[model samples]
Structure formats: C-alpha cells, structure tokens
Target: MPDFSPTELAVPGFVALVLIEMIWARRRNPRAYEPKDTLTSLAFGLGSTVSGLLFGGAFLALFLWAWQFRLFDVPWSWWAFALCFVLDDLAYYWVHRFGHRVRWFWASHVNHHSSQHYNLSTALRQTWTGFLTLGFAFKLPLVLIGFHPGMIAICAGFNLIYQFWIHTEAIGRMPRWFEAVMNTPSHHRVHHATNPRYLDRNYAGVFIVWDRMFGTFEAEVDNEKIRYGIVKQLGSFNLLWAVFHEWIGIVQDMWRAPWGSKLGYLLREPGWTHDGSRETSDMIRQRWQERQGEQTKSVSTENPIAGEAEPA
Candidate 1:
C-alpha cells in the first residue's frame, strides 16, 4: 500500500481541539454539545477509521494501478505537492457534490449529517460506509494525472484535517479576504444547514472557490436560522440506526421500485421518488424562493413607500 499518514499523526491534536471546543461550548453555548450526540459522533469517527483500515489497501491498490497510466511523471517537490493539494480538493468538491446529489452516495454521507448539534465533534461525524459508496474514485483522476497516490493520500489527509476546525459556531466569520478564497466555518456551516436555501451548497473541502465557480455557493444569512441534520431528522442517537438507516432506506426503495425504474432509487437525488411523494433539494429550494418572492411582492404592494406625502 502506498503510504503517507498525516491523519494518523494528527490524532492527538484532534482530541485536544475537541476538548478545547467542548470547554468553549460549555461557557458560550451548552446546546452546541449534547453528550449523547457528541458520543455518537465520536463513535462514527471510530467506526469510519475501522472501515478505512479494512478497505484502504484495496483503494490504494486501485490508485496505484491507475498511476502506471499517468500522463506525466509528476515528481515529488513543493510545486507537485501544491498541485496535488489543489487538484485533490477539486476532486473532493465533486465527490461531495455527488454525495448529496446521488442517493446511493448520500446513504453513506448522511451519517455525517445525522446529528442536530453542530460543533467540533460534528466534524468528526464521519461515514463508516464511505468505502461502499466508491467516492474515492473521484481521486482516480489525480493518480492518473501523475500525482503519486501516496502524495495524493497525504494531501487528502491534510484536507480532512483542515476541514475539522471549520465545523463550529465558535467562529462567526473569518477575515473577509480569507473567507473569499478559503473554506471557513461560515462556508461549511451552510453546507451542514438543512435550511431550504442552504441545501446542497458550499461543497468545498479546502478551497471555497469551487462552490462560487460552480454556482453552488450560498452565503449564511444572519437573520436566517440554520437547523442542522438531514431534511428528516433522525431523533434517536442509536448508533446502529444512525449508521444504517439511509442504507436501509435505499435498499427498501430499490426493492419495491418497478423493474424499469429501480435504478432511479439509487441514482436520483436523495428525496426523489417514483410517485412524486418526496421532495428533492431543488424542489425545496424552489418552493422557498417562490415563497420569498411572494412575500417581497406582498410587502411592496401592501405598504407602498407613500411618496413622502407632498413635502411640508
């Protein structure tokens, strides 16, 4: 297996930061860290690590196999590292976008979004079944484009590490210049939010520029409340239920679906259905936008700014 394990080395730092954030949450907002929720999230992280241990060798083998066909022999250097980091992030952006857009992938990703509380622990709420989703295929291009699978693996580690600190309400916003280019707490919060307008947006892993460029960017509105978790909140903290609920859902839908449309259960957006019974993110956003428009129109029509009643 190609080896570079920045994530393994960062474990201590992660624990310390989680403790610091927990202290901060106690002082600032106790609601930010539910004991059960945090425990569930940590369990999710532990399970995800075990899953990676089991499947990582196979994934690495695939990447290394593809490396033989690389278009360029990108050498190990500072510039190569920089290029790999950026490209790996770009790959992450698409993988993340698909994780929401496609149902099969979302079954795994939804594990990360199951908790209602948002905090540093929330960042550790990873998916145990990510290997089953085949999301790592997104990085195949980087390997085939000449980045060493090991270097790409290192960059991916650093990318995950970078994302951890952003999953909090402890920071309102970053410096304007930093937020403009980097994925900050502000940007990632919108990604976690279940609000209609915020759904399926801000998919950047390291760089915020990808979402802005792809038109999936949505700024957090100070006046708008953000409710964390999936569209349908899983009320229980039962760890097994949290991990497998969506996977079970996908299987159930596919089994019951007609033969011709069964694949839609796997391929379509998370809420898509055969009988128009469910609402996709697009549908939810569209309804929200229309309601907002009507509200604006009604406000303007009913309370016209009376032309300052003929000046004195």
Candidate 2:
C-alpha cells in the first residue's frame, strides 16, 4: 500500500486554524500575531514541506529496506493499529527529548522554537533538515519488529496532525482528567517556554503519560509567564538565517575547538562546551532549584512560626 501523508491532507485545516487564531488574537490582543513573525513561520513551514517532498522518499525507502528483516508478521488489526499508535508516540517522545539534549539534532530542531510568539503558526515552524539529523532512525525498530512501514507512516502522520493544535496559547487547560492523560496546549506551552524551570520539560507528542512516567512533566506555572523562543533570540527575520543559523553555529563552534573536543560540540547537549563555560538545560534547572531552595530557607529564617506546623 502506498503511504498517505495525513499531514498533507491536514494542510487546509492548518491554514484555517491559523486564520482563526489570528482573528482571535487580534480581538484578544493585537500584539499576539506579529506580521513578520507569522510570515516567517509560514515560510519555514513551506520549506519543511518542500524539503520533505525532495527527501522524504529516501527515508521511506530506507524504512522499506529494513522492513525486509521482519521479526513477525504483525497483521493490521484494530489492536495492532492501537499498539502502533502508542509505540510510535513513545518513539516520538525520545526523538523529541534528544532533539533538545543533543546539539547535532538540535541544529535541525532549533528553528521550530525560533519564534518568540506561541500561536498556531508557531506549530507550523518546522525543520527543513530533519533527514540530515537521522531522527527517523528512532522509527526503524517498529518496522523491523513487523509493524508494516505503511502502518508506521500512518501513525506518524496522525501524531504530527495531533500535535498541531497544541501549539497555541488560545486554549487553556482541558478537564483535569484530559490534561493528565493527553498533551494539551497548556502543557506544550511549558515545553516551548525558555524559562529555566520550564526548560526541557513535557516532550510528549500526543500523550502526556510518557512525560509523567518519565519524570519530564511540568505543570504550567501561573506565576511565571512563559517566554517563548530559544534562550538566545534570533536577531533577524531572514528565513534563511532562521533555518540554518544553528547549523552554522555548530560549524563555527567546531572550528575553534580541538579535535578531541570537536565531537562534543556536535554531539553534546546544546549549551555544552569543551570548558565549563556554558550551561545545558540540566545545569539551568539545577541552578533554578538551588535558587528556590535558598528562597525557601530565607522565608523559614524570617518567620520560624510560618515554617513550623503543630503536630496533630
């Protein structure tokens, strides 16, 4: 069976949602939809689609090649479809988590987070260089295990489609039960936040269960407003610069480093350095934790009775 792209089919719906969100934002706050930022996001989305058209076949062919070595003929049933969806989501979770943790992957992934505004268009800001990053390697195991390549493709397509709507600030938290089980706009807002506490949290593609189980889940704090975009904001609105700037930075970083440390610049976490100069998400989170601890201690010192509770 030929693989159908669900994302391609969802293009009209995507455009409609963007339009709706723009109207909604204008009424709520005109500042939410900046003309340049929205256009830049749409351009990146276009680039990603074009790149996929050019390079998608190569990756699909690779998956089919690997499909020849089947461990079992997992038949397509309702149950199999359900299993594939769950497993594919699990694959996506790790792929996404590593996209932040590993610089090589982040080079392609960074553009998605380049926009400072969190709206429907921000979800469309996708990567054009994903094939170069070999992020698809994560899905090969599903094919080798006998879930047909087409099934995997369908699951992945639906996964991408599902994630589209969660990229907005327009929606608030869902019912508590839904929020707990599934990825909501609120949870994804935290994921895109560059705040120290929000860094690298909520990597779920469809299900929030993976994040909660893996200890990556963070509730969207009411106190700390989400500041979207990367730690260092892109200085230009040039589409080419937005797309390839991180890839260029990797080359520049590697050029000055010693041979032994060159791989670290590429493979280590995004903020890692040969010397202890920069901070990774882990380091940032640790520092934030220490600051919170100190604040708690200071409060206790200032009011011992407030810190103390009488035994019942």
Candidate 3:
C-alpha cells in the first residue's frame, strides 16, 4: 500500500461534513453557525494544510531518520496497528495537555480554541505555527520505539479524522457505554468550553479513558451550560490575527517580564505571569469551587430549617 496521509485524503469528506452541519444548524438553530466565524475557521484550516505541505517533508525526514535507530523492528500486522493506535493516543494526551499547560505550545494551539462558536467548522480551525512549535516531539518516542514512520502517520491521521465529528453540537450524547469509553461530542464540548469548571479537563483524543485515568476528565454537567472558546474571546475574525495573535502575546509577555521571570512566560502554564495577576485553569477551577461552597453555606444559613432534623 502506498504511504500517504489519511488526513489529506479526508479533506473532501471534512468539507462535506461541515456543509452538512451548516444545513443541520440552519434547520435547527440558526445561531449555532456564524458566517464570519465559519469562514475564519476554514481559512485557518487552509493555512494549516498549506503549512503542512511546505514543512511536512522536513518533519517526515526527521521521523524516518529516527526510525533507523529504533530499538526493535516491529513488522506491520493487524495487532501492530491496534497497538500503534493505543500508543499514539497516549502520546496525544500528553501532547494536548502540554499544549494547554505550556505557553510555548499554547501559542500555536490557542488558534484552535479561538473560535467562540462550536460547530463542525471549528474542528478545521487548526494551528499555522505547528511546524514552529515542534509539538510533534511528543510522538517522536513512538518512532524511536520501532513503529514505522508511515504506520505512525496513518495512526495519527485516523486520530484526527475521529476527532472531526466530535466538534458538533448537533449530537447531544452518545450511548451510555460509548460515552463512558469513547470521546463523544459531549466530552469534547467540555474540552472546548471556557466554563471555569471545564477548563483544562478532558484532553483525550480517541478514548475518554485516558483522561479518566489521569484525573483530567470532567463530565458535561446538565446544570452548567458550556460557553465555547478561550476565556478572552477574539472579537474579530481577522485571519492573520487568528493565526498569530497568541504568538505575538508570547513575545510581548517575555519582553515586558523581568529577566528572572522571562523564561516562565514561555515554559510555564498559559496564564502564568511575572506576578500573580493572571489565572491559570487550576486557579479558575479553584475560584469556582470556592464560590460554589460559599453559595451552599449561605443557603444553609438562610434556611436553617432545611438543614434541621424533621419535626416528628
């Protein structure tokens, strides 16, 4: 079989699915799809594809070079594909988690989350600076572990394809067992949500089990409505700004920060600063929990009879 990117082959399907989603939203809820947001998302997707074309060869060369030094020569088989899929997903969890935690990676990744609207097109909003960010380093170990470079590429492609359908709000929830095991639309909604309780949770790619095992999983709560996008919404739909704004923010932050703190601006979490002026996802979640606790206490204080033993 010829070695090729599954993602490349799926482009036509991706576009068709986006159109189908637009039709579904128009019939169901007109507000779910915005023209400017959808167009900007498509633009970013195009840019990401172009960047991949221009730089993919270099990365592939590097992977092939590393494959020569692999510890074992594992031949391709049905079982090998299954093993590669699971291993690649585990690698993806770390890659995705770090993309949120470390500013350097987030500079590239933030574009993916820049969209305020959650729809099929939003899945197309990918990073233009992925080549510069070197996020592929997370998968390098697999190449070094004896998986063929082409096999790894195919596995990664399928992972991306599986993620595309999960971006829609059209699907409410999957079957109970599927929701518990696989990454469903509901699970991914939490990943894209800006809600304080949902931030930095559910980083799984294909399986929700990874997030559950690592304590990053948070289920979609019926009471808490999800608001898509980052905490600070990008008010404009400018294509250039959508792709490069976070990178600009990183440079500005580093320039203004003191020498001792400059490194932290890049290496630390996305919201870290020279001082405690900004909030990271952990801080956001903590404040939310505290507010919930205070509300509970106030309710009990106001209605003491509700907490008291029933009068016989």
lDDT of all predictions, in order shown? 0.92, 0.93, 0.91
Tens digits of per-residue lDDT, candidate 2, 1-312, equal 764778889999999999999889988968778899999999999999899989988988888999999899999899999999999999999999999999999999999999999999999899999989999999999999999988998999999999999998889889999999999999999999999999999999999999999999999998887899998899789999999999999999999899999999999999998997888889988999999999999999999987898899
- Top-scoring candidate (TM-score): 2
Among all candidates shown, the one with the greatest lDDT: 2
Please list the residue runs of candidate 2 whose C-alpha ends up more than 4 Å from where it truly belongs after superposition.
none
lDDT of 3 by residue, 161-222 (tens): 99999998999999999999999999999999999989999999999999999999999998
Task: Extract clashing residue pairs from model 3.
Answer: none
Q: Mind sharing the TM-score for model 3?
A: 0.96
Tell me the lDDT of model 2 at 198.
Answer: 94
lDDT of 1 by residue, 112-135 (tens): 899999898898889989988889
Task: Give me the displacement of residue 168 in model 3, in angstroms.
Answer: 0.6
Per-residue error (Å), model 1, residue 69: 1.4
**Candidate 1 lDDT (Cα, 0 to 1):** 0.92
User: Which regions of candidate 1 are displaced past 4 Å?
Assistant: 1-3, 306-312
Error of 3 at 43 (Å): 0.5
True-vs-predicted CA distance for residue 176, candidate 1, Å: 0.5
Q: Give the TM-score of candidate 2.
A: 0.97
Measured with C-alpha atoms, the lDDT of residue 150 in candidate 1 is 91
